[model samples]
Target: MASAGMRRRVEAIPGRPLPYGILGGCTEVIDVEDEHELLGVEWMALGCCPVEVWNDPCVGADESPGAPAKKQFCRPTIEHADPITVYAGAECGTMGWSYAEARQHAEASLDLGQQEAVELGFWTNHLAATATDLTPAEGPVDIAQGVAALEGCLAEQYGGVGVLHVPAGAAALLGCCNVVQRDPGGGPPTTLAGNCAVIGAGYSTANTGPGGIPADPGTAWLYITGPVVVRRGPAMTVPDRPGPSINYRTNTQRVLVERTYVVATTCTVCAVAVTTCPS
Candidate 1:
């Protein structure tokens, strides 16, 4: 039979659903077991360079090529460790909670932290660099107008496979549009437009404002792009002590969980298009 403490630990695991699926779909995850790794860089040539005319036959064909040169680069990856600690008093342990339960909480907390970090990185680094401002004129955005503008932006910069990411507010607006369908199992509406799939969750315009402060509540940001490449390096877990150590004097037991990983994007073309709609 399981002890009361063991039962408590099992019960402590929360039933709350996580947002892991959303993260998995939106970004490419590269898992590593080491502290750091190197990621290769490849990009398309911006344009063709003008060809030079050589008067001398001895100038050689190599010296007068009419095409632009293309090159690739590499970058070293750096790892960041995020750690969280949780403690349960000795009295609480006696009441049925165990050190294992505390560890479970710590792990869950770290997982959520990692997800947040990835989301923030995508927004600040990738999306911010290649965004198109589409602030509306004194009213909520019209779905048709918004879709047209998004298509135009993609056509102008990148007209390849893409996905649309919007915050809850913007998603709600999109859901009400006649062009959007609630069921993915069903065929898309006949009037549906654009080449990107819509994901109404896993995004926020908050903390994207100047100085990292939260943006206006009415502000909404949308993203359209090819796959987002995320590279992850080795994740290590370190405990504060080798085994469960109890401090009788303080009547408390504690554990610390440390995790290290690396993540970055490696998209060559205009991988992401940002659209900002104002309230």
Candidate 2:
């Protein structure tokens, strides 16, 4: 077993680069220290000034001028980033690979650690979201259905089109059913039916089985979009030394990485679609 001290050593790994993934595309990333304050008042704080005919068709000059009512929003919420980690172990005996091989293994572990941080934080937020925000559609949402769901939510929020995140399987289905517009050079689909940027969540439950989100047999294709804020705390340290495990008798050394993440919604309307995609 790796001790708490060993975990600290992992956090101290020098030259560790921040990880990137699809989450970056759809979220507002903010790096914070101990805690972050989400000012709820920032969302729709200003109201549109009421318009009236110059001739006082709407109201008489004797009446007092109307005041712009402030938009109602949630109170400020304090969020703390939570840690998520991944580890890899290798044998220290002669049977173990050479130093170069062990180093490569550690590097691979680091990569996985970074990916896990992004994917876990992204999906955990999705799964934890209220069903109303994370709306559920019938099984297998088509292009038109997906667009309606996404656009409806955006309208509710008084926001224009936003990024739409779908599972890989759902993306494939949409591509097959609709002519997704892409750049001439050929890359990921640039836009879906509603002129929305489509991102296939490669690490979603539908794609990664149990490793990603827990399976919900009732739901098939799930889509999420809106004003999402991802708050990241200090990056976790990677264990520099593959120290032998204190509990295990075998001469096994391990590397571990961990980081904190908090996913939040900026407004009342965060759209999500859950539908069935037949096998």
Candidate 3:
């Protein structure tokens, strides 16, 4: 969203990946080609989960685990595998829109805004400034269309769920962020002979096949990341009275894809300020 002049921090996985089960993922599935740098190379965990009504993705409306049960999402996410998968129940509404279209609109809007400012001599005080050179972005005014285009980018590798996940809550999460929830099965983070099997985030909730349609738009997209095998902390350390504390250094990268510079040139005689606007 930064491209749209909207500033946002790309939050990484909250903590070191739990060997066996990590709840959030979107890692290597989408935007791999379109925007490489922004792609959270390390298994991606959506920063925010939008809340809305859900529809069954795995099966039809007739079959579903019905009951108001408050249970944390169950799934597995480990390190070292390859790519993880993310899932969410989608049925019309924003989820029904196109990710590519949304992204494109945001990107183009940002690009034009920057150029408009520059062309109007809004940036560097060079006399060469005029709105005549500014060219408005082409396509639908509704950005969601361009942004939604991203949805199909990796639908193949991740299947349907890989594309988008409308998690458990939608409205409430409108401006919230996503976190990596780890499942504590107390099982070995790995498997060999006597060890436990680490299925990776790919093995997270087995595509529960979407959620049930609700009367209201209260929704949450439970997305999964691509799968990757992670090894448990050396058993030697966690024998009995010891707990393993995995360490990971966080890296921050600031990239400005677009810039807008506003400059004002007033006719010394008029004594009025001339402003530049993107039309």
Which candidate's TM-score is highest?
A: 2
Q: Which residues of candidate 3, in runs, are more than 4 Å off?
A: 1-150, 156-160, 163-225, 234-279
- Least well predicted 10-residue stretch by lDDT in candidate 1: 81-90
How well is each residue in 68-165 modelled by candidate 2, as lDDT tens digits? Answer: 33444444434233343334443344344454456555555655455444554455544334324434434334455655675666555535444555
- lDDT, candidate 1, equals 0.44
What is the TM-score (0 to 1) of candidate 2? Answer: 0.57
Compared with the true structure, what per-residue lDDT tens digits does model 1 show for residues 70-181? 4544353342223212222222342244676656655565555555444554555555555555535553355556655655555555444444545544554564545444
Ordered list by lDDT, greatest first: 2, 1, 3
lDDT of each: 0.44, 0.45, 0.24
How many steric overlaps are in each model, in order? 3, 6, 69
TM-score of each candidate structure, all chains considered together: 0.55, 0.57, 0.16
Specify the highest-lDDT model's number: 2
Global local distance difference test of model 2: 0.45
lDDT of 3 by residue, 147-170 (tens): 122222223223223212222222
lDDT score at residue 70, model 1, on the 0-100 scale:
47
Please tell me which model should have the higher lDDT, number 1 or number 2. Answer: 2
